[model samples]
Target: MSSTILPVSELTPSAAASEAEDSGGKHPFLVALGQRVRDIRARRGMSRKALALATDVSERHLANLEYGVGNASVLVLLQVAVALKCSLAELLGDPTTQSPEWLMIREMLENRDEATLRRAREAIGELLGSGSAKASARSRRGSRVALIGLRGAGKTTLGSMLAEDLGFPFVELSREIEKFAGCTISEIQGLYGQNAYRRYERRAIEEAIQIYPEAIIATPGGLVSDPASFNLLLGHCTTVWLRALPEDHMARVAAQGDMRPMAGNKEAMDDLKTILAGRAAFYSKAEFQLDTSRQPLQPTFLALREMVRNALQMDQTEHAE
Candidate 1:
């Protein structure tokens, strides 16, 4: 099987053809579905050829599906999801209403407005003992502060300073993942594949949440790609999205001298922007957002510190006060 390649002229999804299928002038749903397919595949570090062979899907079919012009049947999608180790509903960008309880819950909440749905979620969380009044109290103390963003968003440097000011431990979840897997991230993916690496990631995050009562934690950018881990982070932590312009993100990562996988790729910047855009929707789920590209390190850190302190209901002084 050859690599799945979309011709240069057809780099983006085929809007006209998709619309014709609408038999719809455009198929944003299928476009998004295709994007999810590509995103999950990339996260797993599996080449198109690998996925094609693994699923016994023809390379041409996979490429067309990815380019958003091919309307694959349910069976084809099932095979792709199985090979990618993700749920079929996830691949199709639909909420999983498989279980009876889930279907019942969906029925109860269906067609509700956003505000109503939010209240319903809060009610459910409280009932489950997960997001009750105690959770609010925990948030006031800043029990868990998780910073999420792409690689060059200053999670490491800013997380360290925030932890120091708050007098709490700082945990880098990526390093913890490596510890749990007993290998580097690349090696974990290479040796056991993305699914195993995701297991390690889930374990590492769960451990961090369990062992640390109050701390600042920096997370992997791709953590958002794994639904389970992202949900755990969201349910347990006060998440902040540190955003930067595409150029700034690239430059910052380069300045750190750790371009490991992206060093020589001519299209690295374009690829970076596409990944950032794809994950931006997920990243925006954070409780707060800070634009790190707006200022220098000190100023940006100061702003972040203030924003976090405000969220924690802390006074303007350091924890020592």
Candidate 2:
């Protein structure tokens, strides 16, 4: 087709004024062109699929063009115009001749009413001024993380691997807990019950934060069962849940000869499932999650490392802004 030209004389002063007002008193012909193409396709009652087949482009590609979310190559645009049975200028209602969405968006932005701008500013301030503002600020300063998961999820094994790879110190929270409690973990749990064991767990974490401050901490799996304690941990560090199916967890723990959960509980297997189900929601709340089930130890550790790296990068970017 010959190059399509939009006639300036065909446009009304009011329509021209509207376009100018919308486009910051300037021409946004490309954006206008995109909207016009979409309008033409819609007017013909042709679906994106029909246009795609006729133009030999994918339907998704055509939709992206219509939405103006992606740039259409020169050849693609020409093919589309031909399929629509219209010249390029006709398809793109020329601002010298048509109205466009970006022109409208720009107009809204630049010519925004006084009240609207005020509200927008207020919202921005509130979002950046809250307690999370400090957390976000710290997020930029560094990309240190601590991995917290259940016993059989390979805390010590994975912690050493992660620390070596990331060049950070690897500290086991359980070991710290044992020292703080001044008793073996089993002794604490047996004498004081789960509650007292958790107290010792909290104390160990507090001391670790104060001392190490920037190490990869491997916390006990049962941490989330205590919300108050876990929230405290979350505030001090970025938390990731290393997750696996209950059966996988059970197998790993059993392989270690620590069958406390399975010992004479008749409903031992059922109890395990119940505990896993109960903690499912809490685990799901983690900032990042990794499924370790059926994955080799090395690959699972690698996946966890990448996720931490990505999360740290995201935190840095957010904090910098």
Model 2: CA > 4 A from native:
1-142
Scored by Cα lDDT, where does model 2 land? 0.68
lDDT of 2 at 172: 86
TM value for model 2: 0.55
Return the top candidate by lDDT.
1
lDDT of 2 by residue, 196-229 (tens): 9988888887777677645788888788888666
How do the residues 229-311 of candidate 1 rate in per-residue lDDT, one tens digit apiece?
88678777878999999888888887888775376576887889899999998898788999999999999999999998787
C-alpha lDDT score of every prediction, in listed order: 0.79, 0.68
TM-score of each: 0.64, 0.55
Backbone clash pairs for candidate 1 read: 19-24, 19-25, 19-26
Candidate 2 colliding pairs, count: 3
